[model samples]
Target: MLNILRSHRISRFAVIGGASTLVYAVCALALSRGGTGAAMLPATAASVVAYAIAGLFSYAGHKYFTFMSAGAHAFELPRFALLNAMGLATAIALPVVLTERLGMPAAIPIVLTCIVVPLVNYIVLRRWVFRDV
Candidate 1:
């Protein structure tokens, strides 16, 4: 447990993730103020923007710190973009469906979906997208 927590790569990834979440939350809040009905598009757009910005940092951090890929390869950018797109879709769709379609609180579905998706994202990214080993 301690060894896993102490991993330099994981630590850096956590930092990047935390920052991205902060960005998302701020954007969501600002958008949500315009009434719930009006908030959806702006919030979604903001989330996508935040994901892109955060993903850029995440890819660099994972390459250098977590998985320790020395430099970019021909396939790296496209593969990374693809993985990020999948993660972004999951992140966006789950929250929207749970909150809007199901009439649940935004926070509940957002939190629950976030918890679920990260596990999947990590597995996909580690094994398929950024396999350093």
Candidate 2:
């Protein structure tokens, strides 16, 4: 089973990425919608919070499930953190730019960010973060 999964690395990453993206979207929607009637928080702020919360799950899932990285935390964690920081920035900034700046629908940027981040993350994780594995 492990060997089969190891052989299907991209499939495993898609599964984990789907799960983490779901987590992030749910949290972002809840936080963005659950506030005062007229004075709701901006989607960017909500996205940041959501990404931070979901990021914990993402790191674990990618390390153990997607990449199966047994690398040292002292090394990998910082790299993962950097990558996640880049992801978070994209997740937050896209929504803000698309929705607030461009007058697009909120969902547009949310969906775009979700799609774009996973692709970039997969490449980075495969080529850099989990390369030693």
Candidate 3:
């Protein structure tokens, strides 16, 4: 068990994932808060921006550290963008829809989204985006 944990690329992916989540949180907070007394952006818009910023870090980290891909980034980046788009849609759209339509607390859906998005992203990244060349 310990050997599997130490040897698996999933461990590396999880590390990069933690970093990416941190990036998203920082960017989202900054954008949504909008600095001392300035008008804040819509929450959905702020979250989308944050996801995009984290996507860049995700691509670089997975390419270099997680999957160790040496493929041309010209090919990889587009695929990575597509993956991130799906995740962004899930993260932003679900929370807004659940809050607006079903009357659930926005935080509930956002927290759920955070869990689901990473699991899906890990599968997609391992099988598709960062697959061995």
Candidate 4:
């Protein structure tokens, strides 16, 4: 646990994830206050926006601090974007489905989805995007 926190890659990714969640929370709150319809749009938009910001940082952090990939930035960004799109979709869809369809508390699904997608994102990014192959 201590070793994982000490890792530069983990630390950087944690910070990025934290910041993105902050963005999502703020957007969700504002939208929910405005109207029910506004909530989903803003939530999804916030996830995409936050993911874009975090994705850029994750790429640089992973390249320099994690895997230290030798690939060109041009190649890496597109792959990163693609992986991020998948993660973003999961992040947005799960919360919406849980809150709207299942009638669960909105916060429950949001928190769970946020927690779950980062693990998936890390695995996919590690195996597919930044792999030595």
Best by lDDT: 2
Per-candidate clashes come to 0, 0, 0, 0
Off by over 4 Å in 3: 1-7, 33-39, 100-106
lDDT of the structure predicted as candidate 3: 0.76
Structural similarity to truth (TM-score) of each candidate:
0.69, 0.86, 0.80, 0.64
Question: Which candidate would rank higher by TM-score, 2 or 4?
Answer: 2
- Candidate number with the higher lDDT (2 or 4): 2
Clash tally for model 2: 0
lDDT of 3 by residue, 79-123 (tens): 988988899988788757875567665445556666787889888
Off by over 4 Å in 1: 1-6, 33-42
lDDT of each: 0.62, 0.84, 0.76, 0.64
Say which prediction, candidate 1 or candidate 3, comes out ahead on TM-score. 3
Tens digit of lDDT per residue, candidate 4, span 59-98? 6767766667787777777888887778778767865677
Q: State the lDDT at 131 in candidate 4.
A: 68
User: Per-residue CA lDDT of candidate 1, range 84-121, in tens?
Assistant: 78878865885567656776655554455446645665
- Lowest lDDT block of 10, candidate 1: 27-36
Ranking by TM-score: 2, 3, 1, 4
lDDT of 1: 0.62
- Pairs with backbone N, CA or C atoms under 3 Å apart (clashes), candidate 1: none
Quick one: best TM-score, which candidate? 2
What shift in Å separates residue 102 of candidate 4 from its native position after superposition? Answer: 2.2
Q: Tens digit of lDDT per residue, candidate 2, span 1-133?
A: 9878666998889899999999988887777763324425687888888899889999999999888888999888899899999999898888778867987755677788789999999989888888785
Give the C-alpha miss distance for residue 48 in model 4, angstroms: 4.4
